[model samples]
Target: MSELNALHDLLKGLGDEVVRSGERIVGRRNADWSGIPAVPPLAVLYPRTTREVSQALSICHAHNQPVAVQGGLSGLAGGGCTQAGDIALSLERMNTIEDIDEIAATMTVQAGVTLQTVQERAHEAGMMFPLDLGARGSCTIGGNLGSNAGGNRVIKYGMARAQVLDLEAVLADGRIVGGVRKMVKNNAGFDLRNLLIGSEGTLGVITRAVLQLQARPGSVATAWCGLADFDRVTALLRLTRNRLATGISAFEVMWPGYYEYVLANVDGLRAPLSARHGCYVLLESVGGDPARHQADFEKVLQDCLEAGIIEDAVVAASDSDAREFWNVRDAPTAFPILMPRLIAFDISFSIADMGRVSQDCVARLGARWPGSTVLVYGHLGDGNLHVIVDIVGASDETVLQVEAMVYGLVEEYAGSVSAEHGIGLKKRGVLGHTRSRADLEAMRAIKLALDPRDILNRGKIFPDELLTRRMND
Candidate 1:
């Protein structure tokens, strides 16, 4: 049968309302937040339930139709973008919080539920779902799982995968695997849940997940500190980790460029510190006692200030004050308007080497693009640093040049090219910079085993030739 005819038959079987074709699918074509050019797909499938999803995928699989899974469409990576001749499978309609077990400390939610929704619900239930990012209001649980997203609290709570107790996914051929098990430890066979969590939808489409929850802390302390240099930043981090231990929930670092840019570009944001410093660190601690924890938090900062480990510090006097501190950290939310042509990199390095690497990256980027604006900040405790280079009207070739320089440094320093963000189409070619040839082969083998026809998110995560050659064989 012709490819067009096969797609028509598949859509017919799924019914009219479940599928959107041609002009109706225009809105679904764009890449998620990466600013990559869009490719309109053949159609878009909106599956309202797991059965509907299975039915849709079954038909597409039979026709050898490629499917691209989409969640909230807030990803920085291009993993969710649909290509020509592909069908976009969006989980937006499957949003439902099925159950929340208070005693078990688990929340069972459909894949389409937003991270903000989950956080609000957990707060209402007097529990906490700790995986949080700047895009939490729009990013979905399924997207988070697909990317194994790490966010502000990863130093304490870990990544999105760490919070998932159980998961349910639909394989490429429309076979449903996994169940919503709430057990903390289950040593059952192959562990498919872990296999699919960070696969970026190349192996399977995540439909639902049972997430682990933690007791909401009764007291929270937040502070912003100014440090003279990277050494003092690391010193403060070490001191807090040793003194505060697990109570220290966040340790975010911002270089001068990032701090100054946000203050100048983003309106209604006030500087956290009175005087400018070489580096800034936003620290937070959560505990059971309000008065005692506040005293301890303040005392630690006081000691650092006295010992000259920190240049200055401001302990949040109230919740509003705390939000004001975070406002600066979350300034990237304004980038779409402030700097639309920004080239952002989410990479990781060892905690000891991160400062030097960040400095070297800024120097190299500045030397290459003298007129560019570079902003650097991230969760320093977790070794994830975000480096954003803004050059208006940069051509495609210029973007490639920027990526090469940044990724070259990543390879030289033995750093990961992608940290929390998955290696979507954007970073697929440079994936070998971090992973070995054997590693790539193993990953491709798994992809082939799960999706022999190369139908599920075909061009994501792996370089094009790796899978194309194997399928041709």
Candidate 2:
């Protein structure tokens, strides 16, 4: 039979409502937040249950059909983007909170449930699901697990993988594996749960998860501090950690470019401090004792100010004030509106090397593209740094050149090419910059073992030549 005939036969059993093709799939053909060009898939599948997902995958697997898994599509990487002739398996209709055990401090939810929904539910139960990001309102739990996402509180609470106690996923050949186990310690065998969490759907499709929750903080203290330079910024971070200990939840840094750009372009965002410094830091601490936490938080900032670790600072007096401070840090959410053609990078370096690396990157990019604007900010407590370069009237070649420069620098510093975002289509070729050849080989071996047909998320993670070779083999 022809390929088209085989695909038709494979999808025949799946209901029409579950399978959308041609014009019906138009809305699914937009690029993810990464802004890569999108290709419409041959069909989009919305499986409501695990059994339906297995059935659809079984037929597709029998016919050697390729499938691309999609979640909320809020990813900064192009992992979820589909290509021509590929089936887009989306988890939209599978959104349902199965159970919440306040006593056990765990929530069982389907992969399609939004992060904000989980957080809100946890809050309603007087608990907290700590994995958070700007895309929480739209990004799904499955995507979070797939990418092993590290968000604002990674320094304290850790990544999405850390929050997940267990998960259930469907393998490439339509075999369902794993279970939503709420146990904290399970040494039964190899850790399949963690292995699938960061596999980015190449190995399996995450269906449901049991997430660990934290007790809700009784009080949160937020402050915006201006520092003379990166040295002062690091000093403040060290001091904050030393004094606040585990109470520190977020320690975000903003260079002048990022801090100034947001206040200028984004509406309703105002400067927290009247005076401008070399860089800015927005730090938050969460504690059970309200008055005591506030006093300790202020004391740390005061000590920093006295020691010249911070030049000027403003402690948020109300929730509205805290939101105002975070608005500046969260301004990147408006990048699509403010600057559509921006080249963004989410990278990491050693805590000690981050300042030097960031400075060198800004200077080098500035010298290379004199007119380009380079904005830098990130979770300094962790090593993640978000850099965005926007050049006016630049060509595609320019974008590639910029990537080469930035990634080359990342390689030079021995830093990660992608800190939180997974190596989707955008960073596939340069993945070797961070990972060694042996690492690549091991990853490829794992992929081949899990998806021998190379039918799951083809042309993702691995370099093109590697994937092409695997397919030919």
Candidate 3:
């Protein structure tokens, strides 16, 4: 009751966009393609401009209130998530593509602009903003930069962070620091933009950004192939990069279990060949001419089959067919047989150790949690794999065990516990797998220096000291 009274005047003073009570529901809303339950806040405030955001943060910093900055809510990790006694700062009202610089090939867009909006705007202006994920339709540009999101073309265009030229963010002290420059080269001291990009809203609230744009793909071709095992998958990846010698936009691999689940249940999304195999990959190449790209793709697939490196192969006959093949890869419904409550883990390892590490993780998952399915697949070309530890029930106890089993093995393999998904609240305890104690303490030191009062997305990335204090009780 006292907390409400204390925040009432401050929140009410911010204008009609800010609210204290029912605003808490902002956190309860699902924000990602992952569909994890949201950890909500006590209030939510939406500000249209950096000035309004500054005013909101000023009150929050003064009150020492924990604040979670929410974008389009499309992150896999709970970076934008809020907890009790917390307030959520919303950038939804800030959605706008402010300017398009044709010569410089950059777009200054407000943080809340949906990725698709930016993409289409770039397309209409005869350019491309190549940062893409399956969730591009609803995910915000700011959220993509926050998580340093990687998607199909990551091997080529790089992650979202690399595509960002500059950004404007509101720091913890309510000071609006605008760093929106569209320069390609600047050896100007420390790069503050990179610091805020992957900090996952913990360092500051990103309000606007100048994003780099690329030349649009004039032509693209895709092929599907079934592999013998993870070893064969890696070998084929090497072959594709070496022989195909084209723009490989995507190299998505699916496990036999995952492939079968799609083939069985997802109607209209057809598998390229009827051959049953241990793994399947949907490979893509892009170039200037569709005919040359298609012929080259067919030749590559034929060579793989001749080498007996893979079991079977099929190239997409048309654009529609290509989307159908990729739909099976992108959509969750394509893999319906996967347990409803599963821990999706993405880890990176050297190509040499990937097969053994994957096998070890699967065996451990089955032994640790009997009757649960373990689906393994990845963008093998980039040494990234996705492991899903299927649980019969998603009870807290069972999920924790699955997380430990997967992450512990990841640590054993010397792989990052998180590949694309940034380490938010869920992976805080397991970060030790990827880094040493000194590394983490140094990160904490940086955090403390950036946010002295620790009001910006307080409990995310790092475990909360207050929570520790309460647990000691």
Candidate 4:
């Protein structure tokens, strides 16, 4: 029988978990959030348990059918997008909170569990799952692990990898490795969990995760500050790090254009401070004591103002006010509506180079794509800058040109092509810009060793042309 026929036969035994309907398996099932064209799979498999996942993979492995593992579908890159002849292995049916070890301060969750669910459950248990992002409502814990997501709380709790104590992933050949290991210290042997955490499903299929939870802070003080420039922003960041230290939860920065664009375009989002400054920084702190947290937050602002590090500042009077401040930052979701063709870049470089880099980028973008709007904003705390370019009526080639221009500049500045977002299909072609020859060789070696047939998440992380070229070189 044909591979598709054999695959269908194997999935038939798994019951309704397998979606054979061609139409249902197309569209979003084969698309990531990147707005790229979708490549529909032969079918989309919804595996409810690790055994089912392994069984599905076992059959696929035997048939030499490539598989694309999908979770929340909120990825910015095209990591989850399926290709022709490929089968999508979605963990949506695996959604569940297996256990909450309150004593150990860890939450064991299935791969398909939404981040918001994890956060809400942790809060109900008087704890906090600190891996938060704008897409937390839709993004899955497994997707977060695959991307090694670094969200708002990275300044304090670190990235998703840091938040994960251990995880269970099914190898390409259906080998289930790892389970719930809640201990923070495991010096026993090679860290396989770390390998799969950020491998972006190219290495293995993540089935479940054990996430480290922090004690829910009694107080979360947020402040919105208008800064003159990136220098002042860095100064304020240093002050908070020196004074508040681990208490600083988030330090997001937005350029004037980004601030103005959001305030003007996003309804119900009023500027907390005047948008006349060169930039703005939304600072937040969390601590055990409400009164002390607020006082410390206010004192830091007062010091920043006194030192001329900030032009103006407004501390959130209540939770509502804090949400309003974040609304302005998060309002970029209205980007699609605001601009016809928006090209985005998420890059990382030296924090000190941020001011010059963004300014240079904007200037260059304007010259290259005249009348295009460049809106810059991101988690400056960790050197991740998210740049959105408004190419209202640009062609496909124009978008590629914009990518080359921006990423070329990123490379010139010795910055990573992708910071938080993984090197999926969107950025795979440019992986060489950030990674070295040795790095690429190591990654290829790992991929070859783990999935020799390239049956797992093929057409991702490394472009086929580059892979061939590297091997020849």
lDDT accuracy of residue 79 in candidate 4: 88
Backbone clashes in each candidate structure, one number apiece?
0, 0, 1, 0
The C-alpha local distance difference test score for the whole of candidate 2 amounts to 0.89
By summed lDDT, the worst window of 10 consecutive residues in model 3 runs over: 464-473
Please tell me which predicted candidate would have the highest lDDT against the true structure: 1
Please tell me which model should have the higher lDDT, number 2 or number 4: 2
Per-residue alpha-carbon lDDT of candidate 2 for residues 1-473, written as tens digits (9 for 90 to 100):
43476458656887788888778877655457777787877778999998888888777777778888899998878999887678889998999999999888999999999999999999999899999987899889999999998988998899988898999999888899999888999999999999998888899999999999999998999999999999988888888888894458999999999988988999988889988899999999999889998999999899999998999999999999999999889888898778888888999999899889889999999999998999999999889999999999989999999999999999999999999999888889899999998898899999998888888888899987677667346
The whole-model C-alpha lDDT of candidate 3 against the native structure comes to: 0.78
Instruction: Note the residue pairs that clash in candidate 4.
Output: none
Candidate 1: worst-modelled 10 consecutive residues by lDDT: 27-36
Residue 242 miss distance in model 4 (angstroms): 0.5
Q: How do the predictions measure up, each by TM-score?
A: 0.96, 0.96, 0.91, 0.95
- Per residue, candidate 4 scores C-alpha lDDT tens digits across 150-169 of 97889788999999999999
lDDT string for model 3 (158-234, tens) is 88888988899998778987578888887788888888888988888899999999888777888888878877887
- For each candidate, the alpha-carbon lDDT, in order, equals 0.89, 0.89, 0.78, 0.86
Model 4 misplacement above 4 A = 16-19, 22-28, 466-473
- Best by TM-score, which number? 2
Clashing residue pairs in candidate 2, if any? none
